[model samples]
Target: MPSPADTLTSDEPVGPQLATPPAISIQDLRIDYGSHLAVDNMSVDIERGVIYGLVGPNGAGKTSTFKALASLLKPTLGKIYLNGHDIVTHQRLAQANIGYMPDMAPVASDLKVWEFLDMFAGAHGLSGKEKSTRIDECIALVDLHSEYHAMCTSLSRGMMQRLVLAKTLLHRPSLLILDEPASGMDIKSRVGLRNILRNICKSHGATVLISSHILPELTEMCDEIGILHKGHLLDSGPVHDVLHRMTGLLPEIKIRLAEPPDMHWKEWLLAQEYVSNILGEDATHFSFHFEGEESDLAELLRRMITQGYLACRVSERQRSLEEILLDLEYDGH
Candidate 1:
């Protein structure tokens, strides 16, 4: 993508280039639908020049929160500030600072790629040389120059996604809010989307708030992550911090045996309170996530040996961050 830092200046006119505050800020934000409370009083601050991943199960209020940030949904309570302007009171400035993309967007089949982009540029208040330059920049940024003149209907799903993103960037908004951007994308398309997002953060100095159910992908791509459930934000922080907070002393131990274990061994292992996500290739070896004191683990192993499980070796291993996060969810229950 073209470095908007140099080519584009702040839309501010009367004053010199002023420093922007944290890209997004929410204080005691609450959203509701009729009698149903969607998002409770949740507050979060997101910095610029990085990706923030928001993950939660269905009906977790992720979409409602995003719509409020995008100014599409009115919040029943609290304040939302974008680029130092209140989203509700300073609607124009807030809108100018945000580029929001929903899970699904329209791509007119009858329009050519450049024409589609040109239409958006005009909508964003660009004209003449600036419009042409911006359209070209967006096309090249998403690597869509080859399809510059191609019809929108002829593009693939991945191509269409990239195109929608390009449309979002036409105005050079300081914040990008995306909801399930990679939904239904194939592996190749997903990878492409990831790379593009990374490039935009580093090159454009934009703040991104993205939500998805794909835990591994978010773990790999985001600088910070928030876990939400039932409209409540349970936790939010850097990836490592969130993982550590999930389990103060949790450890994953792999067990191997010289011979097969007794029929009741599996049942006994599951009956223990601190065991979960057991994985094994065969009867002789297995691993499970454990959250308990070291002495408690040893006691369980000793009991297993006495019960004829016949554990030959036990070693510790690292589990996926998502696995640990899941453990936290279960613990919350």
Candidate 2:
């Protein structure tokens, strides 16, 4: 299967540019409730056919941004464009291409899965054989074909989430806005949802904008992510790039020796300019922070081997997204 990166670059011609508009663009977006401000001057652009993750803690204005993008809320200040159509003035045209699934969106207990989808399909102006075909296709896309006839209330939380996802896809919307989509999902369900989302972008060229407080989920699933704090966008871009900028790109390096080493090992490691925060687990195990380029790290390993330290294993680990966010919150950023 094609990855989102593959979908982006595959079969495209090399040329000056067609200047294709982004899937969603928000400029100076601000949302307020009476005297309270929710979103403040947030601006971002989502390229087509990518899973863009909106990440923030609660009260970060994620929902307000989604509501404005979905055209369900009027921004106190800002202009939004969906596929080059102004969301404020061209609401119908913009809305016709958006599929929004808010957090905790309810489902009817009396209707069967297919029936629920069928009702939405008709509402989207689909009918007869056309509607039926589209419904079946969406069901299969969300991997709910076997549960097509199951009652809504009989489904598991994961299955119900997929059902709602199928409903969102009924009209084949070009943009998907999902808020906290993995809120109640188990590990298996979350994995399935991730795969399905990747397939959607790869196979259909649909752009997905999903928000979640689950840091590792977004890190693993999103092609790009934006960090929001107190209704402000702190940073946005590729995962590692943003992390590198925010955390100085320092990676913790763990090392293991083939056997117990002489005390000189610690002295030599500390003598290196780029190493810091060195800690030892045992006689032959230790870790430290390496602040250097990739080439420099490789050279340091070679020096270790050349010094007859009998290095057995070396690995690098960056700070997790959760830890980074926690630091941000602690600093009140």
lDDT digits (tens) for residues 39-118 of candidate 2: 99999988899899988777889999999999889999988988766788667756768999999889999999999998
Task: Point to the candidate with the largest lDDT.
Answer: 2
In order, candidate lDDTs are 0.81, 0.85
Runs of candidate 2 exceeding 4 Å displacement:
1-18, 248-250, 255-261, 271-274, 282-285, 290-315
Question: Which stretch of 10 consecutive residues in model 2 shows the poorest summed lDDT?
Answer: 7-16
TM-score of each: 0.74, 0.83
Clashes of each: 0, 0
Error of 2 at 327 (Å): 1.9
Candidate 1 lDDT tens digits, 140-162: 77778899999999988878888
